[model samples]
Target: MIPRAVSKNGYAVLNAEDPLVYKMKELVDGRVVCFSMDENNPTIKRRAERGRVSCVYENGYVTILKGKWKVRVEKASNIPLTYGGRAEFMIQNVLAATLACFVHGISIEDIRVGLTTFNAGTAQTPGRLNFIEVGSCTVLMDYAHNPAGFSGLVNFISKLPNKYRTVVINVPGDRRNDDIREMGEIAGNNFDRIVIRAGHYLRGRDASDIAALIQEGINRTGKEPQVRIIPESRDAIQHAIKYARKGELVVTLADIVPDDISHVQEIRDQILKKQQATEV
Candidate 1:
């Protein structure tokens, strides 16, 4: 749909770092604008070789390079949506949107303003890196269920400077057992502690089945992660919060967005109340 929409003299923005984006360019009949993390990525080089119209990237700064006109905007760290540039995937999104606007003849000043002001909160982008702070700990709540999403989150989590890390996670029963284990493996690699919980809405597998598969993945990592099997999602969250310490980062990989979000928020409120009492 994207390639066809821009097939008729319209501008198309592609992720120059993604190999699939290069194939997608074949479907696009108009000028292909590209965005990438690095300016020297093979896809970006390929796009340039193919005479693509424009490209946006971060080579120390958010830069847009076209044929003869070049515009360098504020660094991604200044953009709230990029989470101080820790969310590398979001930085790619910002690049794509910026390049698309540039193709549409939007002023560089306007694009810069939009990039700086754009906010990604629970309301703005729910179930995707909703950072919640309770006292001194930072809790990241996300609904990353697939391998790709988990991989992206693992990268972001690795960059967080925390004394300890905990992950409350579950995968849907409908997914292949291997896939569920892979998610666990990824979490195990990054987190110091882990809680395997039921998603509360399993897509039709017996209780403990999915959790067991995830455990298999966790154990395969060879890292002696402090592990727990809490079947209920809410209970798992409560367990995580109970043992959470200051400077620790708790990541909840929720399967059901709405239910998990409500439960997390409730836990956050409880933590706040406890903190208030301690302060008193």
Candidate 2:
């Protein structure tokens, strides 16, 4: 007897040991026969009229009926692995392949290869746990804006060596006034100085109003930490950097901007140049 496996996308395979399964073990194949929003396709209608195999796609599965044999909807969830699991496996495989290539193909016998070198390099990847030393202060750039991200960044920075005060600049563009205010409250309890700037609001909301909304949230929190409103992003950054003393952290919240808007690279470069000039 051949075992049968079903998938959420309406695919069924009989006999796990079948030759077809062996040949296509690494591939996922499916076909969409018809797509209709309001009405069924003429072919499906004809099939139903002829009392042949009838199937309907819904909720990532297909419901099929063939004479007395009726098959319930089979979705991707019916499969042993989900789409998310497959994607995660592929990512892990890629990382493994890259590591194997470096370990087996490269010869690093010349320079002293120490475990600390790999540890330090791995710690510096963006969106991962990374830190930048600016004068006596350590700045961390992370892709965290939600409540979870904000909390994680604050917690991590708090544990760093000599971390006295935390300055969080949270400007989540897609957040509602209430959401932004909640984020402000979260920052208020954690950081010493909280700077709220208008981020990328693509929905045509007034930028100043968004800033004010965040300020309202801070006011509600009742934790005063030198809250400043600088509309220009570069100036806001400069303000944070100027006031940052040794043993303090400055966090800048950034969002994805549309193609039409100008990039902040120029502003960043100007700030860096100005900082260097000021130092000298």
Candidate 3:
């Protein structure tokens, strides 16, 4: 019986030896299934020594019972998952969502709605997959600053219809130069043109240094990919948008803050409102 509570600050409280503690002691009072352990039970040591059973005494802790061994259980507040767990959870959730939507006669649009409405925390706003329509061209803003995501995005974009050319605007965080460089190298081979931007350099690092690192990686690939260094992210985006042809695709990969997208959404709303008023 384990007792746990969440504080106002969003932290959890877990304590051992509480009244609600479940499975605290194995073979309590010489019974295989006893309600609680008696303090005077002498068999407790012998049972622990035999390693017959184990228990979880507290909300965030597990206790192991060995022959003639009794010790305090360590509390584990948060159980971190490995890559296997992540893959399992992702597959399970996607399958469940797909099945639910299919059984309910939901369309593709309805799938998006269900994900956004019901699975708020689980479904993140599509980072690189969010297609922004600018005239006849398409632009995408993605958080693909990592090598895996960058490679995946390149492969995905290459398969898209009317993908005449791909312009990659990569902006990596200052903290991860090597990661950004590797990402750039991967992107250089995949995209037609590569534009490197200094992303999040305001956090006490020189933008030029980060750009140089990315350039070094790109040069090492020997692909001679068209590379340009743009310090400002907004300028990089504007430049990419300007160069896009009717059927080309411009992809901006960066570590962007959430508020940046919100601001863009607000601007879009204002524009829509003005257009509506004009029509009326």
Question: Judged by lDDT, which candidate is best?
Answer: 1
Question: Pairing residues by index, what is the TM-score of model 3?
Answer: 0.50
- RMSD values for the candidates in order, in angstroms, are 2.7, 16.7, 15.5
Over the stretch 24-115, how does candidate 3's per-residue lDDT look in tens digits?
33213322311112212334344445653323232323233334443323322211211122222222233334333433455545554443
The ten-residue window of minimal lDDT in model 1 covers: 51-60
Which ranges of candidate 1 are over 4 A from the true structure? 1-12, 27-31, 49-51, 173-176, 204-207, 275-280
Sorted by lDDT, highest first, which candidate order results?
A: 1, 3, 2
Candidate order (TM-score): 1, 3, 2
Give each model a TM-score.
0.86, 0.49, 0.50
lDDT of 1 by residue, 1-280 (tens): 6787775778778776677766787888887777888877766666566666555665656888754445688788998988898888778778888888887888889988998987877888788788888656777887788888889888887887887999998887778888988988997788888998877658789758888888889888999989998888789987887788888998998767777788878988987898889999
Which regions of candidate 2 deviate over 4 angstroms?
1-129, 166-168, 256-280
**Against the hidden true structure, what lDDT does model 1 obtain?**
0.80
Model 1's TM-score against the true structure = 0.86
Candidate 3 has an lDDT of 0.49
Top TM-score model:
1
Q: Local error of candidate 2 at 63, Å?
A: 38
